[model samples]
Target: MTLELNQLSDQVQALSATAAERLASLERQRPAAEARLRAIGLADDELQGKVRAALRYRWAGAIPAAEPVDAAFPCPPHPARANVLAADGSQVYPDRHGVALYYLINVGSIAFRHGSGEAPRVASRPAVFYEDADLYEEEGRQKPVEKIDAERDRRELGELARLAAANADAPAVALLDNGLLLYFSLQAQDRAEIKRELAPYLAHLSALRDSGAAVAGIVDRPRAAGVARLLHLHTLPMEALKDHADLFQQDADFRHLTDGALFADRLQPGERSALFENGSPANLDHFQPAGHSVFFFYLNPGPAGRHALLRVEVPEWVAHDPARLDLVHAALVEQCRATGGFPYVLMRAHELAVVTVAERRELEQMVVAALVRRGLSLSVSHKAQGKAWTGAGRRRYP
Candidate 1:
């Protein structure tokens, strides 16, 4: 076997022991941490100043609320008649050794109408990019995977806007499998180009806002240590604080606990944490200006002792409004209830978006067939052919 299980046993055993010890230690410290949470208050002016200093040095960690908030508010009952709309995307990256030098992106969406008990609407759209113009960046080099992924994210939002607009009469919630903040990939992209990229999508957010639809980005099993990082900052001495490096010094103190893991025991089933705005530079710089500063809260949608913590991200408008936030919260849990602790719409959307390996090969075959019809010769790399041949074999004793 490729993994050599016998050779890895000792390492796995050591990891298991380390994990058990950490869990016990974290449990032992829970009472003190919760006490700190209760005593926490937002020192807004002072906190903002620290954030600015960190930003000056290009720190990328989450900026937390001016004060600590770990409120475990119960979930509001879902509206008897509401619509849940969700969109997800999948892509086939450009392959140099394939039948054609092209890429494809497909988005799948669902508009699930609750209360009415009617059949849900579902659809998928696939786009293939083959032209030289579509394949190349502004600098004439092949477009990177980051650009393609960003476009996919944009298209997911675009589809949500279209769906939300179509169902404007009713209360609609648009859900994405990620955050609403501008993606980190844009840091590597040109500033002007990034702004251009954001314009249309931001306009869509505005449209949703005007229509009074709630938009949320749901992250399952989130690994973010935003709040944990904030708590670490609290332990730093003032002398070392200005450097922004102090945040990392105590990172190991909470390294084993994620925001979700820490909140899992505190939140009852169907409960959510108090809203906190993300302090990331991306949110502060681009999203906030457009009234879309990203805010998030952890939710336990699963049952007691089996809490499924989800980090739900919403724009500022949704965060400030109690009714809108309730709808988003209730609808998500309700959706999860029916799908075994995960949003059913998201699962269906992903299934519809995903491109299986067999389907990809068929697409390549179609491209090859079309080229042959046009009397054009195309060749795959010999290395790729060799890999395919070797990939199909199995070891045996004779």
Candidate 2:
């Protein structure tokens, strides 16, 4: 209890006031924003130029959205019978001071056949990296957490690909718990590193593209302001825009609004926004080259009054094909309806794939026991030993 409730009362009050004010502001600006979006309605030649200029000038705050977008979409009715396959991953990061120094990526997957009213098939697969080559970077350093995360993402896609292959006869939809695009940090790290990391993942995406499973990534409570950024760019004087720093430095109209908030009122239950491409370099360079450029749409999955904003990302092939896109849209809305907010398969996958603290500790003990039985003395850093002895709380009630 570092913070006392009594001490935080005034701050909490201030925060509530700010939140109410912002909510009111959002309500006020929503009309204008909708009109602005309607005005732009997929005409993005000028917006594309703005995006390119922002990239060339290294615009710090520039967000990438598809140049060609259909900013309006009506709700597609749920299909009678469709297979929903979702994959989620969890990881155990390498610990230098633990009994073993290795990382683990566990992928959990599920295939739910709606309309059949049957039980879903669920499974989990865990890959442990014990070898030096698996554990280390190209430069001989222990692989960082970001690299490990990307590996987990790759495994998630691989799991989707495997499931999609098995259920080819049925209309299948592949789901993920995150964005389809490779994270920006991985892209900025190194060209070779990004290429190496994304090669297999991109391949899986390409395979999934042709595999008949409509792959989509579902993001709950999304805060992506891509459309807001484009709207901001539209209001700017194109001729005077020289420095990218102006993007961040200027007083922008759509400062803190998210795509969700902007589209919430318009999208009723089960409805989705226009499909917009994400023009990040990672998408253009890696995924697009392989014919799987990532695109997205905002969806409202909750009831009429309580609109839950869910962002759905799909690859180029899925976006282009109406039948595939309908599968993704209807499948997601149905899944959300069953789960109340998010996809049921994704929730189950997380449960199956998660590495609990007890499991991790038990594995470490097994490692120590094996070493001891082999007559090899086990040694841990004194700092680690000291912390282990004192890490537990002295008073559970307190």
Candidate 3:
């Protein structure tokens, strides 16, 4: 019995010692992990503070009220025509070597009538453009893929802008997929080059706007959306307060909370409706400063329907941040070191907006289909009823 007791005591002491060692090791690991994060370009106090402030302003429920502006032309004259345009770009990952090949897809359409009642007809085929991967050697180191993506983005946007401007007609409304104007405010090593590339497009857009036409550029994935989502999630009750804690424990449960049933049961009957009612679709506009990316969202609502635009900004910080790139490099190095080969490195853009052009089209089609589904005949057509010409000894008749 004495021998058994001694053995038991020894085992307990050994277990305690192991636990202590593990705790100390974890303590040591925490700082190292934090340092690694910092090395990967985690913002210090000032940058983080700025990010927070930007977020706060975005979700403060303080949307600015626009002062009404006088119209350029009074009514009771000729009816004005409006046009809608949207453009988006996608990148292709060519191989496992982290090479980025880019393509731009631009769509523009014209609407002849006003209000949400009339459907717009397609005016032009979606233009597809591509840019080849460019390579540059710096101190025997090739330029990073992120820089290439930024350069391509600038080039593609410039082309899209020019195309839209050329197609604009009298008293028309132009919608840009990303922002009201190209962001000349990017901080890249090739900043001047980017500006020079975009100058013509910028001038054209400015000229169009200056002419009495209402030209608006929108960035649908504005960084404000992420901040708004964060604020929204914070407003929900804690899991402990819920009757079924298990159901609300995970983020997926909260994210797929579209039905309003889970949250409804916890609140008063009327309060349940209020919780899910005022919500907008998820906003994706998150700022990746180290990556030098900005997402923006813009919306223009006329009599017919709302025109939405999405813009993504890729800046120089994506390539310049050594710490940011190091994490990627380390991951590749580790895989290569372990497996005797590394897998392809491909980075994807995080979605910044759920309401894409596809989604908008789907919604619009649904509405039109619903009318047909209810057995109503729908007809759409365009006819030139009249023609008027100004100047140059021409007959004004159609």
Candidate 4:
């Protein structure tokens, strides 16, 4: 009722028509992209040369790997007796208006024993930060949510590493409900700060690598166009790429295309696309030097008709080892088949980690009781209290 849909009917219809036109345009462009993919696969060396030259100009894109660009690899045979370990993390961000000024991170994991038909082991670990160092930056400003989210990501991978190491009896595949590359917006941060933030995450990856576990990061319906950007670079004349400034900024035919949309029809159910090395500075400059360069492939872990595309990223160690690569592919397909499209373990882990509203209210109540025991004020900010009073009601105007 607040949205006034009737007044927006014309605009909605126009938006729908624009969407339809965009789809048609994308369809017309698909064949050319596919052709370019095939052409580059036939002459990968030429593309590689171009990628090498273009790397200094751009921040992040995709670089071709050992696999042919057009290759559609079938799902490899899964291990008869393997283990699948997945971890997910959720957080309660600090609310200045609330009684407490702290954030919490909870990581949930599942250790599934394949071929034994035994029940999977699940666990969750939660930690709260209240120290000034944890809550604020050197400038005395409250730490941003992105920094906290980075910590949560680190904990998720750390949990997977711990579980993978312990469940070493069988070949283990450690899964994360995220991309292997760090997602924190580090472009604005100083080099020293960036290095400090990435240090712990890299350490955890090293742990997973040393544990002899195949690790993978699963992203459902990814909208990444890193590969598409590569294709655009391929389309440009080699001479045109010398201008590092305008090289990637130029408007192009493939601008609207996503790797998912490009590969949606190409990959059959249960098939995966060829691998591509991620060209992000974070992957190339930091992780690669540490022997953990991120590589990715698109997979359709399918039941039949539905095209549930996923981007699976792995470290250099896993990507190079045939057995580890195959296990990640096979195990992921098996996990997806159990839960329609998405991985069942990730679903369960998320469920275990998520904090519901009632639980948050209960936690706040506990905080209030503790504050009262300490003879501290048990009052929320006036703005928050006012919202609590009128949040569910509607306002009328003349």
Model 3 lDDT tens row, 333-380: 221232232111111011221235575446445545877788876543
Give the candidate order by descending lDDT.
Answer: 4, 1, 2, 3
Which is the leading candidate under lDDT? 4
- Give candidate 4's whole-model lDDT: 0.88
TM-score per candidate, chains pooled: 0.91, 0.89, 0.31, 0.95
Off by over 4 Å in 1: 1-3, 41-68, 184-189, 237-240
Q: What are the per-residue Cα lDDT tens digits for candidate 2 across 153-216?
A: 9899999999999878679999999999866333565777688778888889878877888999
Cα TM-score of candidate 1: 0.91
Error of 3 at 138 (Å): 7.4
The root-mean-square deviation over C-alpha atoms between each candidate and the true structure, in angstroms, is 2.4, 3.1, 26.3, 1.8
Q: What's the alpha carbon RMSD for model 1?
A: 2.4
Each prediction's whole-model lDDT (CA):
0.81, 0.78, 0.32, 0.88
Candidate 1: minimum summed lDDT over ten consecutive residues — where?
Answer: 59-68
State the lDDT at 46 in candidate 1: 59
Better of 1 and 2 by TM-score: 1
Worst 10 residues of 4 by lDDT: 185-194
Name the runs in model 3 displaced over 4 angstroms.
1-80, 93-133, 137-168, 181-184, 187-201, 210-212, 225-398
145-198 per-residue lDDT for model 4 (tens digits): 889989999999999989998999999999999998777734535667767888
Model with the higher lDDT, candidate 2 or 4: 4
Residue 59 in model 3: lDDT: 31
What's the residue-level lDDT of 78 in candidate 4?
Answer: 90
